[model samples]
Target: MAKLIKNSFSADLVRQAKFFKALSHPARLSILQYLAETKTCITGDIADELPLSRTTVNQHLKELKEVGLIVGTVEGVKTNYCLNTQAIKDFKSSAISFLEDLNIDTINCKK
Candidate 1:
């Protein structure tokens, strides 16, 4: 069996990676946009608003929920889904900090 390599990156980097990975898919991004636009917890039939099938939509929602980008609450036979504002704020800070640390100057470009 091959040996598993240890992750040497910082905790923040790991978290940022998870967020990026979760947002990498278009379906997940669309779900977030829908939640934000609705501005309220949605229950039942979210797939109707998207181009994807119910199963596909659920999988995308699962990924977002896993990353704390959205939250879902079970109500009777349905589940209500909404954006996790705190998590979104935290992710925004993490992403901003990472990009700012790069300190790229547009003035120093190749000819």
Candidate 2:
């Protein structure tokens, strides 16, 4: 286990690593896709939309919510979930900046 030293190189790297880690799973990606398409959905609707069992879908949704990718509102027996638009935009901007910072265009590969 790597120790995360606050305000250090490894910690900063790990922080950036988590942005991709959050979307690394197919189930989580599916949940995001569904939420993006549907605008908003109840827990039951998500269960019905995916092939996974309800329990599995619920678990995946919980993870998505924890990562700030989704927001959930409990309404009595139902839970309404929607994508956190600001979070999504931040992720997009951060990813774009990270890639641009790599400056891959300068690579020379002439054979």
Candidate 3:
């Protein structure tokens, strides 16, 4: 596996990459969609709603939480997870800004 040279890129690039990577898996995407649809859900609730096992769902949840896409709160023996609205907003803005800065219209490469 190729190692990432963190010093070679801007911090924003790294951060954006992490955000995209967090959304890379289908399970992760599904988990996010489910969480968004239902304001908050417990681990068991998520497992029940999706086809994945509870263990697999938990792993996906861990990845989402790592990137601040979701937040989890422990209530007794269960963990309640919900979408992180501000983080989602920030990621959207970052993606939009990146695309806007691309200046694709000005590029004249022959297709």
Give the best candidate by TM-score: 1
Off by over 4 Å in 3: 1-6, 40-44
Candidate with better lDDT, 2 vs 3 = 3
**Could you tell me how far off, in angstroms, the CA of residue 8 lies in candidate 1 after the best superposition?**
0.8
Off by over 4 Å in 2: 1-7, 10-13, 41-43, 109-111
| Per-prediction tally of clashes | 0, 0, 0
Q: Whole-model lDDT, candidate 1?
A: 0.91
Model 2 whole-model lDDT (C-alpha atoms) = 0.80
Cα lDDT of model 3 overall? 0.86
Please give the TM-score that candidate 3 achieves against the real structure: 0.86
Q: What is the C-alpha RMSD of each candidate to the true structure, in Å?
A: 4.9, 4.0, 4.3
**lDDT tens digits, residue span 1-111, model 2:** 246676555654575677688788898999899888877554545888889999998888888787788889887788888889998998888788778888989999887
**Ranking of all candidate structures by their TM-score, best first:** 1, 3, 2
Report clash pairs, candidate 2: none
Local error of candidate 3 at 79, Å?
Answer: 0.7
Give me the candidate number with maximum lDDT: 1
The TM-score between candidate 1 and the true structure equals 0.90
Tens-place lDDT per residue, model 1, 1-111, is 123336766677778899999999999999999999999999987999999999999999999999999999999999999999999999999899889878886558878
User: How many clashes show up in model 3?
Assistant: 0
